[model samples]
Target: MVSGTVLLLLTVLSVCGKAAAERKLVYVTVLFRHGDRSPVKAYPTDPYQENDWPQGFGQLSQEGMRQHFDLGQFLRNRYKGFLNESYDRHEISVRSTDYDRTLMSAEANLAGLYPPSGRQVFNPNLPWQPIPVHTVPQSEERLLSFPLGDCPRYKQLMNETEHTEEFLNVTKTYKDIIDLVRNKTGLNKTNVESVWSVYDTLFCESRHNMSAPDWVTPELMEKLRILKDFGFRVMFGVYKQQDKSRLQGGMLLGEIVKNLSTMADAESKKQLKFMMLSAHDTTVAALQASLNVFNGRQPPYASCQIFELYKDDNGSASVSMFYRNNSKADAYQLQLPGCALDCPLEDFVKITKLSISDDRDKECQLPSEGRDKEVIISLAVSGCLLIFLIALLLGVICWQKEPVSSRGYHHVINREVGEES
Candidate 1:
């Protein structure tokens, strides 16, 4: 009996140990914006032009490369044992937008994450191995880019959003700042939506310690910064946020969710441990907006959003999210609005469904505009009346053209044969 009790105790301990080990990380998907780059475009009155940048407009800077490299190292350290020490094409996948800055950022990031190991090193002097980074043309990039065009409903939502009380109030409050940017930047028109680009160019230049015009004082920059943040809020969420997300950010979220679901499948041969996306700040913000956890600020250079999947011994899968907006700060945990940080996969899907559209194209179509609807109805009614009038006129013309006797042919035949009399 004593021996049997000892054996039972040992069995229980072993089971617990196995359970703890089984609750291991199964898959991870990380979406990070490309690092800082030269401004995409310059304002009309700005001193810096496209020619001023070393690589011209929108190319990644050396600092941008360094930022991504550091991020890659952070990822490498974070997933030390889970991912292979060296790059494994089969175990990990990477993708980026088809822009120079984003593509180069991915390359630089990969260099740090998976420095060629042992025989894989092609050159003795340079320890770098080529890793494939996939991308679609900018026109077809729906997965990694946000605020995608071609959705009429999304456009309608945006138009409606601008008219909302909150949007109007913000716009009214910032009218003075908007006017200042218009005058300083030499732009013909400047609104809440259009001012961000101006702010972006100025902000990028400021970061590089470039001198600005006397009109662009520190106080003016602060006001522009606030407007810039408001612009992001308008893009992602201000009114009908979920509906907008269904068309914008939710598309990418659906793909991520599908990938997560695929990894959960026991029969799946693809043991894809890591999936990485290199994209823009809008991409990050749109996704965070869909999750309803946006921090209401622009995601800085090399900012990352991480989704981690874990499975336990009972074959249950759960997901956890983290946001790393500042390199200097550790990633902060994010929870779904109504769910726990480590929410079950099923529950996660269910909660996220509110933001995901079942029929994007159908949802994108605008309902008939009120004035247009009335016009169409009036035109249809007029067309029916015109047809009826034409038919009546034709009948009258036939009666007028007919001979008196032939117009009542049956009566004429009866009189001629004397049958009716």
Candidate 2:
């Protein structure tokens, strides 16, 4: 009787293990902005330039490093057993942008995620060992360097976005401040995108506790504070564009879809556990915009946007998104295209496919449309002309060993057409 019972238990365990094997596990992708730093730009009247900060501007501070380590520790706690105690080549990968802050931030994160362990830490008395983190130059970077704002279409979309209801609303709300900025900056009115820049400079300066300008009155500063609070809305939520679903939003969808598709193609049927991306706020905004799951506020420093993949009981893939930021304690959940909290990857792709815009940003184009369109039309016409010429040449050959004069005439016509093209 005892032997029979033991055999039954073994059979049950085998079945459970098999079921677990079929239902692929989890994969995670984290997209994060660099940690806090001094402002990227300074106004003409600003006191501190790049020299004010210890490492100068844009480098990660010690505070930023500690913040990322804590986050990495948080991730370690979250994925303790899933990610090996030591870095496993097959199980994990980290990609970062080429900036010093981003690269250093990634290193700090790795420090927390995979600390010295077991054999790696040779000394029982001290724990320290070297671990590798990978990165690519920003220009050549693939995974972490997407949604490049250099596209002409994205620029046009941004221009349109600036005219959206939300933008207009903000402008109306801050008209007086806009006037104040105009009077202060004395910039060309035709090229006045810098209205917002003044606020950005002041706010960043304030955060770093830099000395304020004397002209900045208390009331004006308070108004700037109000505008500062509106930063998230302006950058993400309130900024609207009819083509945003395609230009900005679709860019993000393309990335998520690409990663998921790559995994789907893998023969191992390995559950994707992590997708870490070190990127910018624009990257975050574009992604959240595409997902239609934005938090109304812009993603802040070391703001990690996580997409966790999972499997249902039936062995299907599911995905979920979460946003973590320096400003927020809790990670906010985002509703993916399909499959609920644990959404299936297939559904996720399908919903995203709809947001992709074909033209992206045609309005931002500076080059003449006439030339581009004409080139296409002309090319088609030329291709047809070439085919006609070839056919004519063949006909002439078949007619009578192709006379030199006739061939010469055909050659001249081809040359003329080529020159015109």
Candidate 3:
């Protein structure tokens, strides 16, 4: 009896160990919007100047720095065993936007994430230890530096796509905004109204409690407020017309999906545990717009979105999205439209159809049944129309073929002539 019990215990322990080993270490990719800042733009009539903010416009304040530091501490706590007590170059990598605000915020976050340890530690008199964060120039950052703040190509895309049905519908729906922009900036007879920029300006203005522009009447402000709330809808609201999405937003998604495929292809080379991007709210907006996962409100300071890909014991992969904003009490768990929270890697690539958005993906958008559904629906509609026309023609011919009594035909013809006369 004693021998049998010992053997059973050993077998059980072996099974447990094997099961644990089957699961791979978790991988995380985080894309974060920069923290709070002074307004990106100043209205011509506003009293606030560049010096009004201690750091000036488009700069992160002390509060922003503190928020990111706290966020870093949160990450350290959450990923304790996953990360070493001291930073390990092999295990982790960090990338950031080239802008000063983002670069500074990343540094502050790193300070909290790693702190100081061992001989690498600095003097005890200092408040914090130094940690290095890696970054490339804005021009070279393919992952985070998008639309490059105010890119001409992006502007061109937006302008060209404005004529599409979706853009026209959004324009017609917000027809009142043209006059409001004219009144605020005092630029008369403007031809362009970027729905995105308008919403962003209003959201920022409302948040700061700035005086409403003279052109913005109470009714108009209300409409703008609603438009502000609909930013997320405009991004992924599944509008009937899809052609307009080929603009900058589409370009942004195309890049991300291509990157994902490249990463997947190189799986045999090494484990890509995480991809971190230091970016702005606009970058976050573009990505979320593609994934159909955006909240209507602006992404707040130091907002961090996490994408987790799980490799099951059997080698199957799944993904889930987690969004943490400074303003919110808890992170949001995104439920994608067609896929589950833990979506299969294959399903992920399948849903984010490429080349449909851009010509750059000629080879990647391999012909597939899923890609042809819209064309099939259009063809079905055309076939139905043709069948209806043929049936109507046949009915007319049958009526004409009826050998009506000569008297009946003559009477009908006479009636038609009388009416015409």
Candidate 4:
């Protein structure tokens, strides 16, 4: 009896171990904001201008390089067991926006994530190996960029958003600051949307230890920060957020969902282990907003959003998300709104489909009311043209039927006939 009991216990233990081992990490996709950089531009009348930056406006700083490199190291440590010890081009892919800052950030990050190993080392003295960071021209880039300008419906939605009660309240609350900034900055107009530039300028200057003007105080800066955060909300949320997402962030989300689904398939030959995206804070915010998981704050420099796909023993797949906004802390897991922390892959896809659009261009067309007005105008103009054409044709027929005696040409025709005879 004792021997039989021990055998049953061992069998149960072995099964539990096998079950645990069956849950394997299959694929990972990471989208991270580019590291710190100088202000994209300065407001009019600001002391710091484009020339003040080391590499002019919007260039990445050395500190930015360090931040990304550190983030790369963090990633290396986090995925030490899963990722190959050496950099394998086939295992990972990196893409960045065509901006110098984002490209440099990706390169810097790779320096940390994949330092030279044996054959990859071109020079013993130089530990870094070149890793290609792919990008497309800014004009052609749609994925990984937020609030794309080409979508007419998105623009219309934004215009409608301006009139929402929440938007109106925020605008009214910040009217004084808006007017003050307009006067101080020499701008002709400054509203809640445009005032964020002032805050960004000040925030960048503050980060670089530049002194603000006498009028710019701590209290005012705080208000500006709030406004800046609200500005992000305005871009991706605030009103009809899900519809706006379908036109904006959903584009990228759809691609991610596709990638996750592809990885979930057991027969998929895609051997890619990790896909890295280096983009701006707005990109991160846009994606989070589409997921209905945005925390209503700007994603800080080097903030990373991670998606991990895992396969279970029963051939079922699951997805998990994590956000690493702070350098010192571990990436905390983010649960989908309706699903658990480890959401089933199908459930995730179903929930996210609400934000994704089947045809972006079709969805971007003018709303029904606007389309109806345009159609009505078009039909009226076409009807008038048709009526005028019919009238012209009737007048020609009437002229042909006029009596020949009434026309002097009749006499001319008779004379010509006599001459011919």
Identify the leading candidate in terms of lDDT: 4
Best model per TM-score: 1
Candidate 4 lDDT, 229-292, residue by residue in tens: 9999999999999998999999999999999999999889988999999999999999999999
lDDT of 2: 0.68
Clashes of each: 1, 13, 1, 0
Pairs with backbone N, CA or C atoms under 3 Å apart (clashes), candidate 4: none
lDDT for each candidate structure: 0.91, 0.68, 0.64, 0.92
**lDDT tens digits, residue span 136-199, model 1:** 9998888888889888878888899889998899899989888888887889999998898998
Tens digits of per-residue lDDT for model 3, 1-421: 9999999999999998997566544676777877656666655545555666567777876777887888788778767877787766665667777788898888788777888777656787664776556887766665564344344433444445656686577667777675566566544353333444544454455655766556657676666656654554443333421332333345656655555555555355654455567778767776776666767566778898877665657877666778898544566788767888767778887776631264533422323545699799999999999999999999999888887673263533457556632
Predicted candidate 3, C-alpha RMSD: 14.0
Q: Give the TM-score of each candidate.
A: 0.87, 0.71, 0.65, 0.86
Stretches of candidate 1 off by over 4 Å are 1-20, 369-421
Error of 2 at 159 (Å): 3.1
Of the two candidates 3 and 4, the one with more favorable lDDT, higher being better, is 4
Better by TM-score, candidate 3 or 1: 1
* Residue pairs whose backbone atoms clash in candidate 1: 153-364
lDDT of 2 by residue, 140-174 (tens): 65345435565675555566677887667777878
User: How do these models rank on TM-score, best leading?
Assistant: 1, 4, 2, 3
After superposing candidate 2, which stretches have Cα over 4 Å from the reference?
1-24, 122-130, 140-147, 182-197, 214-242, 264-266, 269-272, 326-328, 337-339, 357-421
